[model samples]
Target: MRRFNLKLYLIFILVLLVRISNAHQETIRVGFIESPPLIYNKDEKLVGALVDYLNDILPNFNIKFVKTPLSRVPDLLDKDVIQIFPMYFYSAERADKVHYIPTSFHALNPCLCALKENKIPSTIRDPKSFEQKTIVHLRGTLKNRDFLNFKNTNYLELPTQDYYEKSLKMLKLKRAEYAYFADFQQVKRFLNNKKHSNIHCENSHYPKDEMFFVTNKNFYLKKNLELKISKTSFKTYLKKHLSRVNWQVD
Candidate 1:
């Protein structure tokens, strides 16, 4: 009778342990926009440096990646439709809507590109120098406030759905004298392609912007996510990952 009672007790403890472990693991829905080489769909699979990094670091959580439009991210996050969003620049307007991890993981360098054949002067080193020039960029990605320093520059904001192709078309058609990209590495990828050989970017004078992972205001695991990332050597991991993809990380 003593042996039987001991066996039953052990089974109960094991079951309780299993239940506790299961209770701690959660399914976190992560929202992502189409930013190639960082986060984009390929062969029907969502794959990129950020995707791989998150999957590797967050083993305790089941991450479900959801493709979201760039413009709808803030609303989706507010509605609790997605628990987390990666690779977003910090802005006062955005901070009100989401909780930003205290640490920034990457610095995105701005790039101003123009067609080489157009022979646009490379003297445009500052916002003041962009006077009377028409620049094109993704709509939601940039705002009039961003170029407030420019006196009389014209900005043609394209839709975010297929911004990469549209921005390139705008430049090639001479509709815009310059194309502005938030990340130099992303623009470099397009410039490397033979089809876009005419597009060339001059050394940028704009300051680099830091990018961070943001979570919904009420996300239960926000602190846990921040703690995990804080403990990891994310900068080293990001440098290696970017190098592998032929992107320069500074």
Candidate 2:
């Protein structure tokens, strides 16, 4: 009886040791860009809706954040360097690389943006009317890809710019006749310039599409753990900032 009791005590101590070892482990890492209001970097610190959300809900989990270009979110997630990024459109090529989180939005309402001076057709209502307008677009963005293959348009397509807002400014400044934009909040921020630049969203625009997170197929194999973190963290993010006016698209 004494021998049996000693064995049980050893097993309990071993179990406790394992648990402690796991507890000391570091948290999973994540990445994002400096898109203001959505994701922003201030004084070398990252703060925004996404960051704030993680701060509130991911405390229980171990996480490290890496700041990078928005263009890299899908690659990082695929590499498993970070856990999530917000406000991205779904594509077949991306689908081949990672699993996407189901969300309310896929693509944003994109429109034809033009300098106040461009002569837009009264008949212009869709992509078809962009026949002769010199346009600025971004690489890897839906707008760029959608317009690149155009055999119909007679105008020139400008090189992809670093920022979408900057591209719009380029269009307004006569660098191009038009530049299309999708993210409303970002667009609003760009247009708020006191210069009161003459740019307008066409009365006829494309329908809004879906945007959501793509799981890094390579990095995240623990579905249960990721799902747990994703659910709570995203909810906390929305709960805290969703009510703020800055988040609205209209």
Off by over 4 Å in 1: 1-25, 117-128, 148-151, 235-250
Best-fitting candidate, scored by TM-score: 1
Model 1, range 16-124, lDDT digits (tens) per residue? 9988987888888898876656766666676667877797778777789887766777898989788888877778888888899988776788777888875544444
User: What lDDT is reached at residue 215 by model 1?
Assistant: 86
| Candidate 2: tens digits of C-alpha lDDT, residues 1-250 | 9999999999999999988977986686766544545565455665667776655544566657776455676677766677666556777777777666654322455656676677554443356756655666544455434554556664443333345556766775686776656555456545664344677656243556565755566544345434645456454454454344242222
Residue pairs whose backbone atoms clash in candidate 1: none
Candidate 2, superposed: residue stretches over 4 Å from native: 1-25, 69-75, 104-107, 119-128, 143-148, 152-165, 218-250
**Total clashing pairs for each candidate:** 0, 9
Which TM-score value belongs to model 1?
Answer: 0.77
lDDT of 2: 0.58
